[model samples]
Target: MMLGSSNAAVDHPTSNVTAFIRRANSIMRQLSSATLHKFVVKFPLLRGDADHLDRWVSLSAASRARRIVLDLCPEVEKFGDKNQMYSFPLHLFTGGSCVGGNPCVKSLYLGFVSLNLLPLAAGGSTTTSGFTNLKQLTLHKVSIVGDLQSLLPECAVLEWLSLTYCSLHCHDLIIRQPLEQLRYLRVLQCRLQKLQLQAPNLTEFEFTNQQVPLVLGDCINMSMASVELLLLSDDFDYICTKLPVALPHVRDRLTVGTAIRTEALVLTKAGAVFANLRHLILNVTIHGCPQASTGVLRLAYLLDLAPVLEELELHMYCVSAPGFPRNPRDLDAMATSPPARLHERLRIVHMTGFHGSRGQLELAHRILWSTAALDRLIMIIGPRIKVDYYFRNLTFADTGRLVARRYIQDQFPGTVITVL
Candidate 1:
């Protein structure tokens, strides 16, 4: 009931201070038995000898508060045995030393202890009798070497759990508890070789690490129907492969990136796993390939596959023979236009890295000529083209102007040609 240390400190702890303490205690006696929920204490520095720290401990013990956050001065290294039995419903021990033991009375809501000065207590573990009501748990920068299996089991009602930068070297990280109650779970930069999550109700599962390979074996089956957002990395192909086959129920909204194709034929046979996809973004980096024509063919194939695809983005680095023949075989094939029914649905077409090379020009001309329902055709010249060569040389603008003057202006009088 007695709040520690007043704003003004007298020259000495006189009889007048004792009288003030007695008066404060009298006021506390008149108050009701309603429990206090939150308490925050800031200490500039413990002034006196070790005994003075004892007085602060006594004052803390008097308060029956549930939640406590202690911001102590950096110089105060040791909070003696007076600190040992100091427990609360939620305790946050920050900027101190030798504050190793657990300090939770009922259930630690969000306990974070930063023990900078001392090596962790040997065989020490944060034990919770049963945080049946606990909702969220976060442990950061702690060195808990042994098994964490005993820690979180009590937190059966935990909704969100995060362990960041903790060197947990466990053989198997198995969530034996039914995490159907969990909504969000994240383990960032932890040295976890394997993790098995069986949360049927988990909505957001995000794993961000370059080295760690997320193996979602059969847990994809337990994910709830309401689960929407799933962000995974490149090494998640094991899961991505099974995703379309196993979880065909939620294949529509799943967005994946940079995954390697273990078997190109198997993935292709998956038949547009992302069939209901709207926005498709690809950053395909093909190495040692003879030509970028492979990527182009794959893109054309994907165009047919993704029926609902609206926005298609591609970053293709074609590292093949610099110059291509003006009239490629594909252009000749496109010149023999397919049925008009095929072109009716076409609305917009954007092609970047247009060098106006023979093959590229042919491809552009074919695209412009073939799409009967095409409304907008955006052709962007690649930045690799030297500006000096483009403006100084007359041949640069000649073909484009000739095309505008001859084919477009004469043949398709209504179409617009925008040069950027």
Candidate 2:
């Protein structure tokens, strides 16, 4: 039987109102920690100057929790300022009763809470002593302040770590462990200055930090990387110069996804080269409706950096809706795309962003004339409302193929054309 309450609103929550909720712990504390395999608690509308979440974590630790999820913030924090977030208890690390501390807690998740690693006593560094067996840890919207070193050191065998919208206002967040078994690491929408990731066995690393310089020490074994917010514009040359010095081996598969207003010209000047990069995908989003007379010309220039790139995909997007999204009835369908050669090793090319503007039409044809040995040319077309409503009323796909076949006939006419 499920034994937690989802009290929508605690009118007064006075001593008498919360007596039953507080007393429910007596039944829980009576059971050994080994008996509880999983525990979940969701408190709703904890009102005015009252928070009992700390006691819940203590009880979970003492009860030998294996998987624990505590969500203290389910609604907008408009009540008393003191009741916004719960402070996690730190005494669970120090073992007094049992020599084996929180040994069963392998999966731990805390949402809208505070994990202050600083010692509560007069003077002591917070220690992750009992968290030796922690394997999977996720902290979302968690304010991790003070000494954070204690919570990460004892996690020697941690495999996966994800921090989303977490505020770590410390000097620099470091991850260093000899032969650290960490394989996957992702950090998104974080406010940090410097990040140092030194995991030897790391395979997949995805980071989206706001212009934060990443100093990688032991990421020599990375295979797949999804990076954003690093090479934002041509003005910032830090990522270009620092990437090789930090991680000598660039991942074979690279995906550069960005929504900011950027031109392909700016990305080429970054002074970075992918000597071993195999496949590259560019997902760029423009700020406003692109002019019909001109194409962005941002993606074609990147081909020069990856000499051996075999497969390339371009997923273009526009911020605003285009006024006229169809080709004219009398418009000429056949025209020279352009100078004829951009990539020698390129075999396949796929484009998804199309509004049938003259600029995009010209760019599409240019790719056909340039690649001498290209195998496939795919252009995906859709209406502008695809952005506003998102997949509810998008039915302009057939137009994508019509534009590709009639106009921009490649110099190598054998290249297969696919429109979706």
Candidate 3:
């Protein structure tokens, strides 16, 4: 019989109790939840109101979510409360501005916030104790005044770390604590005079800076299989001085861009070191080397170094002088010939700023003649030079087409040459 009855006076329904319970059970079935189990709270205008903060704290503590992200921005002065408005087992925390008191949030994904000396002193007692479960961390536009040695020890399980636009006065950042599990590390736009890394399991690293004598001493002592390094500088000597010691690991691909230099020593050194690389990109300025002789010699040296080189991208800037000879022989000698031990593996060549000048044309001819196995040669002519003038003025043999067309056909019979 049905237990629950429609009687208002009844303390507990008895007439239709069995059927009512069954219907209630069916209606109250648990809802399906999403697979992406993460919570994010981004309050750009967060003023840290007591009521709102308390409500947020309660919600966070009550939720059984897996991951949580809190991006908070409040007035600089109001960040002093020691008690966190919300305490939860969050896997990630991205914070802006400063929290005055040691908030319970352990894992931090810091962004665009600099911790000054006073804040470091105030927050010293918190000791980063609750951050044991933290795995990944990113620091952007942040400064560390105290010893990172104290701070790093707390993040025991920290695997991946990145620092961008940061300044540290310390002599060396030695990760004494075992970062055995650590894999990826990146440091960019940092004024770290010297860095020492000891992580053995690290796989990826990226460093970019303008500082001179930026020493990376015996830190990346681990055996890494793949690495990508980019060095940008107005002075080649500065780069030469730093690179030999910084990059000891054999990398698969290496990209380098240097300001114009009259001396060939720096380029020569680079060619010697990175020759075993599979992919090489050179963005060089050949301004002061008006003779083109020095430039050609440097290119030859570079080509000889990379024996197994497969891809080559050259962005060259050439400055012409009245007395400088625009001879085809000079061009041929520079582009066509290289060390006999050169990598026959080279399949692609991309040359930017092609002007179709006598010098450029001759260099193109040499490349087409030398690289018999070349699959593609793309020459992007600069807008400053007139293509019509180049084809009409330059001398050509065979069919009555422009000089550029005739020269292209004779030199690169099999390869595709696109003038764009």
Best by TM-score: 2
Displacement of residue 161 (Cα, Å) in model 1 is 2.7
TM-score (all chains, Cα) for each model: 0.45, 0.75, 0.56
User: Largest lDDT belongs to which candidate?
Assistant: 2
Kindly list the per-residue Cα lDDT of model 1 for residues 222-252, writing each as its tens digit: 3222111122222323433433443333322
Clashes of each: 1, 6, 12
Stretches of candidate 1 exceeding 4 Å from the true structure: 1-127, 139-144, 210-255, 259-290, 293-420
TM-score order of candidates, best first? 2, 3, 1
State the lDDT at 163 in candidate 3.
79
State how far residue 147 of model 1 sits from its true place (Å). 3.6
What's every prediction's RMSD, in angstroms?
Answer: 12.8, 5.3, 14.4
Tens-digit lDDT track of model 3 for 1-420: 011222322233233333443453343232112222343443321222334434443344233223444443222434423233222222222221113322233334543333432222453432334344457766654556557665565566777788776666563456545676676677777755556656666655666554444333343443322222234224544444455455544356556655543334435364225434566665554455444343333454444455666676665554433112446555334444433453476666666544344444554555555454655544333213221122222121121122345455445556666544
Model 2 misses residue 194 by how many Å? 3.0
Instruction: Report the poorest 10 consecutive residues by lDDT, candidate 1.
Output: 89-98
lDDT of 3 at 233: 28
Error of 1 at 213 (Å): 6.6
Better of 2 and 3 by lDDT: 2
